[model samples]
Target: MRSRGTYYLVYPLVIFLLLVLLFPFFVMISTSLKPVKEVYANPPHWIPQTIHLTNFSDIWGKYPLGSYFKNSFIVAVGTTIINMLLCIPAAYAIARLRFVGKNFMMYLFLIVQMFSPLIVVISLFKVISRLGLLDNLLALILTNGVFTLAFAIWLLSGYFRGIPKEIEEAALIDGCSRFQTITRILLPIAMPGVVTTVIYTFISAWNEFMFALTFITSMEKRPLTLGLYNFIGRWAVQWQYLMAAAFLALIPVVILFMLIERELVQGLAGGAVKG
Candidate 1:
């Protein structure tokens, strides 16, 4: 009887939490579909009487949204690729090899994760200016890759260590070279961690604003965050168009999560247990 009562109480709490979390998304969609006049309607209409679907078209035609999306995609994918190339090898070595300062290297990576890019942005700006990469997508790619690498190394190292060493030894004894063993054996086993790392790094790169805003100067090179600036002016803001563009921007991330929902869950759970 008491357990049943507790379940009844818990249900309302869970429902309330879900509503709280979802309320902003509902508002964004509602505002996006509302005509400009209906957006600030007196008494605040939760639902618009007349839907305006042209906001999407207006934002796309009025702004360089396509270029912004392309820049963001290029930076995110480039950053993920570079991070994987660097972190995976380092993670494998950390997990399998017995080099001096191995423990120190692990500690250093962990410590590096504690620092935010904001702290070093000025120094980075100077170096990027010197390299003539100040307004380039490569600048964002390099910076994002550097920051995301520590997390990848830490996460992949834990996952790699969780794999049974005997499997690698068996493959080696059967005439497989060390590189072959890593490529053919370990990488397949550690795929979940790889997916998690890639998704996380990609998302981080995608949503990056400070570095993108600071390093990128050309209008054509701006990412989605900067692209949204078109909807705001010194005098007034275009709320409807901004909301529509924001909603559209969410599609890629939502699709990524939906497709890899299962792997993401399992990878996080496995990392928790393994670590």
Candidate 2:
């Protein structure tokens, strides 16, 4: 009873932290709905006297937001797919296959993670220019895939290693080929890890701003992150419209979380353990 009573003391702190984290989102939504005049009014209002619903419609029609959204979706999906195809085989090989320099190869993947995209932006830009991929969504897709590959392999390999070898041996003894053993038996069990990887890759590619800004020259090729620039000029900032677009931009990510929220939690937990 005493231990249970002590737990009540932590509830207030948790609630306080939740409110603190949520406050900025609340402010953004509030600003998005406020009229331009009310935005800078003295003693800013948390709730607007008049909500401006036109912000959404205006921004949509005025800017190439739809194109930006399409480009982001294309790049994000492409990055996730390429990462999965490449990482799955590499992770499986590292976790299950025994060969010389296997440990060295694992170390190499970890080393790659230490290098951020920002560090090689100039070199990458030159390469993309040579490939004639500048201003193309393909450029973002390819670059994101390469940047995210190291983490995907490291994560998936850990999950792959956690599965019992006896299960694979049983499948093999039952006349299943190596491919069949992996596809039918191992994949279903390792789905949590896969989901985790998908979410990470998708989000990273979607939110990537530096490469998108640098590589994309055409207005229509820009992603949602770059689309926010439409509301800013050299002299003025359209705070309301900017916030409105930003709020709308968050919807897809929120829906994604809602859809796979369960699998993500399970994957993270399961991926933590080593076989």
Best-performing candidate as measured by TM-score: 1
Clash counts per candidate, in order, are 0, 0
Model 2 Cα shift for residue 205 (angstroms): 0.4
Residue range 1-275, candidate 1, lDDT tens digits: 56888998998999999999999888999999998899878888988789899988887787788888888899999999999999999999999999999999998987897789999999999999999999999999999999988978887887898899999999999999999999999999989878878887888788888998899888899988777764574367878888888898888887776765665465446546433
RMSD to the true structure for each prediction, in A, is 2.8, 3.3
Q: Over 4 Å off in model 2, which ranges? A: 1-16, 254-275
Candidate 2: tens digits of C-alpha lDDT, residues 1-275? 56977779778889899999999899889989988899888988999899988887887887788888888999999999999999999999999999999999988987886688898999999999999999999999999999999978888887899899899999899999999988998889999878878887898899899998899888888999987875575367778878888998898787766766664455445545423
Q: Which parts of model 1 are misplaced by more than 4 Å?
A: 255-275
Could you tell me how far off, in angstroms, the CA of residue 117 lies in candidate 1 after the best superposition?
0.8
lDDT of 1 at 261: 61
List the lowest-lDDT window of 10 residues for candidate 2. Answer: 266-275
